[model samples]
Target: MQHLRVAWALAGAAAGFFLLFLIQAHLFGEGQLVAGTCEIVTLDRDSSQPRRTIARQTARCACRKGQIAGTTRASPACVDAQIVRSRQWCEMMPCLDDEGCDLLVNRTGWTCAQPGGRVKTTTVS
Candidate 1:
């Protein structure tokens, strides 16, 4: 019947639109950019010579997925996102009430210090 044909056509159009929406979302979903502060170290380069450190600088950066603002041994820089995630703590709120959390030097781990003089240290594996 004519009504049945029109209903089928409408259903097909709706399905097509849904499929298009999904494809668009999949392609653009990971395009988010994150902003952070990073350190920059400038080096003096000479031909046939080792690079020498010139100055340490800081900058605000907008990094895309898979990259993060972090610091290197020599200076602040944009590093792999995984490294940032592994090095960061206290942001995860692992400390309890009446406790203070601090990120360890070199970002090797974190420590939670309680007001009672008890401390818990967690190292990154």
Candidate 2:
């Protein structure tokens, strides 16, 4: 009977440890799994803004056959392709004196210095 009790206790402890391990794996392992590159082909359009957010900026990677990763904005006649490998935004800047600029997959905020003591904010989408 004593042997049975010890065996049961050991089994319960093992099960508990396995459950904790699974929980930790689920929380931390999933995020690490999603890191990789994304290859995309940009569609040509006459409009200044690209169709998608990823289409607006150049990705960071080696260009092959006239296709590069860093062609973020393309001309209406230029059909650009890129691969965005990283999840973080490529660039970030201030929109204005008081506004904060953040560049994301779909939106890019720009702050340009004017001739005078003024700054211009431009949002590229």
For all predicted structures, in order, the TM-scores are: 0.33, 0.30
lDDT of 1 by residue, 17-98 (tens): 9999999888766543345444333444334544432232344556656776554432345667775577665555556766
lDDT of 2: 0.42
Alpha-carbon RMSD, each predicted model: 14.1, 15.3
**Candidate 1's error at 69, in angstroms?**
9.4
User: After best superposition, candidate 2 residue 47: deviation in angstroms?
Assistant: 20
Q: Model 2 segments beyond 4 Å from truth?
A: 32-124
* Alpha carbon lDDT of each predicted model: 0.62, 0.42
**How many pairs of residues collide in model 1?**
1
Clashing residue pairs, candidate 1? Answer: 39-76
Q: In angstroms, how far off is 118's CA in candidate 1? A: 2.6
